[model samples]
Target chain A: MMQALVTCRGLTKVFGKGELAVHALDGVDLDIHRGDFATLAGPSGSGKTTLLNMIGALDKPTSGEVTIEGTPLSTMSKAALSELRLEKIGFIFQAYNLIPVLSALENVEFVLQLQHVGAAERRERATAALHEVGLAGMESRRPSAMSGGQQQRIAVARALVSRPSIVLADEPTANLDSTTTAELMELMSRLNRDNGITFVIGTHDPRVMAHSQRHIEMIDGKIESDTND
Target chain B: MNNFGILRTIAWRNLWRNPKRTLITLIVVTVGLWSILAFSMLLNAWAESSRQNALGLLIGQGQIHAAGYMDDPNIDHLMPPPDGALRDVLDSDGVAHWVARLQLPGVVQSEYKTLPITILGVDPAGEREISLVPDKIVEGRYLNGLDDDAVIIGANLAKRLKTTLGRRIILMSTGADGYLEEYSFDIVGIFDADQGFEDSYVFTGRSLLQEYMGLDDEIAQISFVLPDESGLPAMIDTLKAAAPDLDIRDWKQVSVMAAAMNSAMKSIIYIWLGIMIIMMSIGIINTQLMAVFERTQEFGLIRAIGLKPRMVLWLVTLESALLMAVGMVLGVILAVLTYFGFQGGLDLSGFSRAMEAIGSGQVLYPQFAPADFVIYPVLIWVIGVLVALWPAYRAQKISPVEAMRHAT
Candidate 1:
């Protein structure tokens, strides 16, 4: 049996208080195995992204607990959580968020720089990651100079350069065209299968759900369906 | 990247983000520092010139008079000679040059006009050694020998009396016994001294005044020049020990008006500096606050990426420091250019009389100690950083979520 890389038990996130209170996440329990490609599906206003944020340690759960590789995230210090994010988890955003001042290679190398890697080794790693995402000769191009899909590919290269244990992508193809979306999904799926890198993608896109090996659907801040493809 | 290196790069890049604003701020800072430098140098030059005029032209380094002569200097209170004991005291104190002077109130008459004036009787050769009298001869020549019976009259006094070089002037005054005494002097030189009073006075040999007044061995006062003004106290002690009855006065005592003018000029410079500091502080505070407002999302992103609250505060403070340093560098460059370009010479077409009254020449030359340039910019930099604290604190207090949600 594959070891569970992430486990959540009765996790709840509440915002504000009293009459203005919002239950962004309620009692979400899940186990995600190592090397799994999972898609979290939900309609707008559902808690799918919130759950992913919690699992990514971008936010905290108000109740219950979450553990990554048996280290409980709720008990971790902010510095420890930052270390976890830097060393173990990588993130890709739907908006293809890249520091406008940096070139594609520099954007990918930022994580390695933060990890205090040597400049030459960081460049080598960043180059390899960009090549793996099919952006080998475009390392010098800035995000604004690239297409949406190309920019998103650079974002993926940035996510994978540090060789993190899990890649959390939030609606990674929401802005790409159909052909570009297919190419991206295929690239991500290939990296997952070949490198044994786990992917936890939060999206409502049917295309994403259809391609994933496992799918979890959420509605009104609760899990509506959990299915294995 | 290393923290400080990253901070420096960001700061350098940030300066170009709003070039117009930065340029405007730099201009204000540069002009402000320039004004301070120019004003300080002008005032310093004025003070230096005034000191030189009073000490070199009129009072020398120190003066000696009858005990009550400062309050009422009358011919009856003339100093008695030979002042050998006082001369020995001044010599022991390392005074460079000493001269005895007899001051008498007289009516100086030329061919056409007569004017009331104070006649200064000096040892012609000793006067040249102790004062600027020899250099101030605008026409003819300075009095060379006591036996020649020649006098150097002020240019204005000679003009008033309608006298020329080699002309004769009659000097009449009351003697020590209150009887009218009269004498005639051959006018050989005329002096200006760039001062109104000095330009209106007359100078003759000391023995001539004593012989005319019928007090052959009497003197009005003794004056000496010292190398350093700081040595006045020791010099005064020596004079007191040598001649206990003779009163000694330093240049400071003789130039009260000059001292007051110097004090007022200094006060005005400090007040101007205070106002510039306040204005610069306001400008810097406003710039930092605007920066905070504009970079809110970027700051939020960094905070969310794991920078501590204190780090954010340090970042903002460092940014402010960097900005001030840039501004200060530009300001100092501008000030130095103006200072050296002016070559210490400032055209005083505007305040010529004020300059003249303070005994400075027409062109105001700014003089400043080296510390003034180095210390003031650093002080302004620190003040700029201190004023940036409000914006830095505000940045630190901003929550990541709130900061991300708000638009710039």
Candidate 2:
């Protein structure tokens, strides 16, 4: 009975129009509660990523509504949405999209810098975030100098540095090997348990699904089943 | 970190992301600005040379004459020497030097030839202060005093008249009684000057010419020089009020051709600047747009991480501004070095005939104006940043979703 941090009511997303129209999400409704480590799991064309993007406010729904803390996202301006994302939401991409020119520490501090954080506190929080993601001694390393797993860890550190209300990760482990994927999952689970940080991951991997407290299966632009462990 | 600090860090780092492109653009800006500064200075020197050559011929910075003297330089148009309010004004603070002369049309008869000429009756000491004719004596000597009773003619005129320094010549002009009066004087000096001046002018002592013309201290013109000519208008106004019957005119009115050339040179400078600005704008726009297009996904990634469109625009524009600023600094340094290289003046003696045609000296000295250092660089930078804004706007308009589709 935890209060919903994110709510989607009869959300729909269509990519095109007319006979060739592709419905990426059709009348989808969902709620993500606080402290819930959730995963949207499905096959390739199943609308899970689209639904995640809608929830993350990265894309608009064709109809219905998406709300974060009861504030409708459709009503916010682009700049307001950006501000909301900066203060409340974190993102980890499948490619580990870190700014190549920035050091690992700078990458972690970039969000706080955008929020106009003081230099000393931004450095302290970024260093601690990197340490929590097991990247303690690699603060000065650029993304190009690090391995795939190490880069993804830095991305995670960057995501968690600002202490956002929710983390939206789209196929975060899609480029990782089995050992690195299990390690990343364990790290996310520990963060979720200790810090009560909510996570919504989009993936087709069952190993990723096993770590989620709430597993939602999507098929053909619709939620086929929702199961909570 | 502060907002500008972070933006600057990213902008600086991004400038060097592709070193080759950055350096090439930097060179473009540097060379463009250097050429603008160098060529502008050269044009300025050319204009200044023309003005000096024209003014030094006979007109000083300004002149005073009887009301109708400029239209008709005869004995009837002469006025008494400066005194009263006119003398007080001429002797005031700003006037550097002034000389009164009785200039009249006449003919010179030498041993073998007779030719028409303009005769100038000058005070030897005063001419030394305000006249180039004093220094141009290539042979013999200038008249020592008002009572020397000698004359100096141009070398070319001496050649035409089959005469040389120390030879006697007969000067003839209409006297105060409206009849022809003739005076014979020994030729004490032969001077070399510009072709027109060499062919047309003769100089003698003012007292000797005045006595011969049956007048007492009468002068046809008063030519003066000021330390700085910016006060020429005010000085002219004061003199006009002081001597209402006398006409006071600045060198620009006295030397119409030189004034026109000066105006034309200034126009050419602005035309050249416009052309350079167009070329530099094209180079800047291409370089910045390429950088934006190359980093489309990176821009998207930042946007997804909560950077507003305006911030993206600012970051990109800042990058370009940094590039332009560094290039402008290097260009200014290069120009200053080039100017020092010509410390002795850029010699155009090899093109002496061409230089003489335009009334410039054999040596051209490049001058450094405040506009060269402050106005030009700041202008180029502001324009360069403005030109870069197109690419920044493109970066701002990049859709995060579309960019993410190109990810990995």
Candidate 3:
């Protein structure tokens, strides 16, 4: 049995209170091992994104405890949590959130820099990440100068540059065409297998579910089914 | 990367992102500072020169009179002429020149006019050292040798009495006693000291004054000149100790009106400074608020990348400081050029009479103290930084999630 890199026990998240209260996540439990490539699929207003945010430490759960590699997130201070996020977890968003003013190389280097990596080493690692993501000759180009796929590739490069333990992606391919989506999923799948990095993606796309190794189906604010491919 | 270095790079780049906006703000600040510097320099120069001219033409470096002479300068309080001991005291104290003078109120009668005037009895040789009489002669010559009854009338007084140089005039005044008396004086020269009051004076030799007033060796006042104006105070102290029976008067004491004018000028400068500081502060505050509002989303992005709230504050402050630095440099350059341009000599030909009436003539020059140039810019920088604080505080309060969501 491989050790679970992320563990959640009876996790719950609620928004508002009393008469206005909305239960965004209700009692859920999950264990994700190292090297697992998984997808959480649900319709709009489902709890898949909320679960992903809690796992990524971007949001707090209402009831249950979540731990990344045995460090309970509830016990970590704000600064410690930020450091953990910087050094251990990477995130990719649906909108391709790369700084518009920075070149592709600088965008990738930003994460490494936040982790306090030295300039020389940061540049070398960022370049290698860009090359691995098929953006080798586009380092100097800004986000506005690049196509949507290229910008997404730069975001992927930024996430992978630090070799983080887990990558949490929320609707990462929501804006891409079918071809670009297939290509992006293929690249992510290869990186998952080749580097043995864990991935937790939240999406409603059938293509994302087809490519994922495991799929967790969510409805309303709770998990309806969990299945292995 | 070190936070400060990263933030500084961002701050520098941020200012240039909106080049036109930054340039306009810089121009406003620079023009404000330039006006302040130019006005202060001009007023300082005008006041200083007026003081110098007044001291040079009317009062000497210092004056000596009997104990109560200044309070009521009647002829009865006049002292005897300074002897060799007094001359030695003057020499030891580095006095460049000393003049013995008798001042009295009198009426002048010429061929076709009569006018009241202030009579000044002087030793021609000694008067040249402490006064501007030699160069102030607008019509005729200054006193050469003490002829028994030679006199020099001021340009305005001569005009009033309808008299000219080398003419004889009757001067009537009370003697040392209460009795009215009259004497005749040969007009040797006419002088114009570029001041209204000075242009109305009547000067004659001390010996002729003594004979006319029936006071053989009595002197009303003894005035001394020093090479440096700054040395007048020490010289006054020296004179006080040497001539205890006489009262000492420095240029500042003799010209009380100049002191009042100086005080008023300083008050005006302070008022100008206050107004400029307030105006610049308002401009700076506006610029900072706009900068914060424009960069809110950028700040949120950086904050999301693990930048602390304080780092955002520092970045805004650094931007303000950089802008003020650029403005201060430009302002100082402009001020220096303007100061030197006018100081190189500006012609006030159109306002000569007005200046002469105020005791400044023909040319107006600008000047500044070294401290003003150094301190004023630093003060502007501090005010700018302070004005940036409100925006910095607003930036510090922005929530990363809220800011990122709004995209503003």
Candidate 4:
């Protein structure tokens, strides 16, 4: 009876045309409800990242549609999609992408700044986000000065600072060691449980799938299995 | 801070991310603008020198001659001295100096040779203010007074006539009786001028020439100088109203060559500006495009994080504008310093022959025109920003999906 946060119907994405065409995603039909901690697990070229791209409004599906809270993404302009991404959904990329020129605190404040939030509130929220990610005293450190795990944590802080509706992370732990990976998984699990924030993470790591409540396995652009733990 | 504030902060930081490349671009813009301002100043100085040199030789800012005097310089075309309304206006504050000259066509004979010349009957006191010849007397001295019977000839004429200071020469001209008359006068001075000028003119005391030629007080020309050339037209209008029977003309009308030089200098400045702009444009375009290309993944990352493409474009453009502004500030400072470095005047005396040929002085003085400061910097900045738009456009079109790719 939970409210559906996202719905995808027959979503497909093709990379090229004719003999050289690539079906990165084909006919993916799925539903993610509010407060769901979902994981899409797959190997390389299995359409998990492509699906994440579709859900995050970073790209358009060549056929079918993705609707977030019953509003179709295909119906939105680029500016509208950018607004949606800024205000509604947050993204964490595989590469720990923080703006290199900005410090850790400024990277976290960037999203709220884009949303035209007040400077005082933006700084307060950014500081709180960094503290929640266990990086309270390293606010002035640039990304280049931080380790891979710390940088990824700052990326997480940037994602959650604006308190968006859904958080989409692709390969969030791919660059961290085992100790850092375990710490990140614990932090994400705690945020989901305590905040009731929806999270859809794409990864091929089984450790990540075991931490999520629902696991969806994908291979060759199709979902092989969908199950709840 | 707001979106623009953050963008500006990022832009300022990113400029130094590649300090070497940014510094090179700054140098290009700085040197380019410096060259433009410096070249313009030099040309302006040269043009001014040409104007003053030509005018000071004989013509002042303007001249007043009898109706037919310019066409025929004989005694028949002479006019009486300025008085009444004419004298009142010429004596106004606008008129810096005025001198009456009884100039006429005459022949001079030395012990060895004879040649035709234009004889200028000048007052020693008034001529000092209007003519360069008095100050240019290389040997002996300028005329003593209106009654001093000794004459002044050019150095070239002195050479040709086998004459020197204290030598006597015969001067022959048509007197008031319309018949040729001759008189012997001592050569008291020899002036050094350009070759053509040295060979063409001879000077004597005004009263002495008048008495010798049988004219009481009639003069052929009254040339006047104004405090500023901008007042030449108004002064000419008043003089024409006062003496309607006489012809009043500005220096531009009296000397076609000077007018041509002024117009030509303007064209040359514009051409130099165009060349400098094109050079700066190429440098700016190359630098912006390279910066945009190198930051492709960064652009993608910002776009993915919800910045609109137009915002990315504005950010890139702002970076270029800041770069240009800094360079222009430094360029202006450098140009100003260079102008002051030669404040005493840039000596061109080594090329005196070429300088004199063009009616310019041996020393050229550069001036800083306030209008060029506004026009050149603003024009360069606007054009620099416009040229940077191409790279900014390229940055805007970067897809957010590109963020997933390996950045080079």
What's the number of clashes in each of the models? 2, 0, 0, 0
Top-TM-score candidate index: 4
Candidate with the greatest lDDT versus the true structure? 4
Cα lDDT, all candidates = 0.79, 0.89, 0.80, 0.90
Model 2's C-alpha root-mean-square deviation from the true structure amounts to: 3.3
| Model 2 spans with C-alpha error above 4 angstroms | B71-75, B91-94, B105-117, B139-190, B199-217, B227-234, B339-344
Taking the tens digit of each residue's C-alpha lDDT, what string does model 4 give over B91-190? 9898999999999899999999999999989989998988888899999999999988989999999999998999999999999998898999999999
The superposed Cα distance between candidate 1 and the true structure at residue A109, in angstroms, equals 3.5
Docking quality tier of model 2: medium
What DockQ would candidate 3 receive versus the native complex?
0.26
Candidates 1 and 4 compared: the better one by DockQ is: 4
Over B1-408, each residue of candidate 1 has an lDDT whose tens digit, in order, gives: 665555555566666667787777767777777678677877788777777776777678778888888877778777775348765666654887888888877888888988888888888888878888788888999887665588888877777777788899888888877898988888898887655765557888877778888777777777788877788888888778887887877767766776677788789889988999898888878887887888776665555444556767887888788878877787777777767877757778588667667677667666756787888888888988998888999988776445543521
Clashing pairs in 2: none
Q: What TM-score does candidate 3 get on C-alpha atoms? A: 0.84
Lowest summed lDDT across 10 adjacent residues in model 4 chain A is found at A87-96
Off by over 4 Å in 1: A1-4, A7-10, A60-66, A69-84, A140-144, B63-96, B103-119, B129-205, B208-250, B344-354, B405-408
- Give each model a TM-score: 0.80, 0.89, 0.84, 0.92
State the lDDT of candidate 2 residue by residue for B306-345, as single tens digits: 9998999999999989999998999899888888898679
Ranked candidates (TM-score, high to low): 4, 2, 3, 1
Superposed by TM-score, candidate 3 places the C-alpha of residue B236 at a distance from the truth, in angstroms, of 3.6
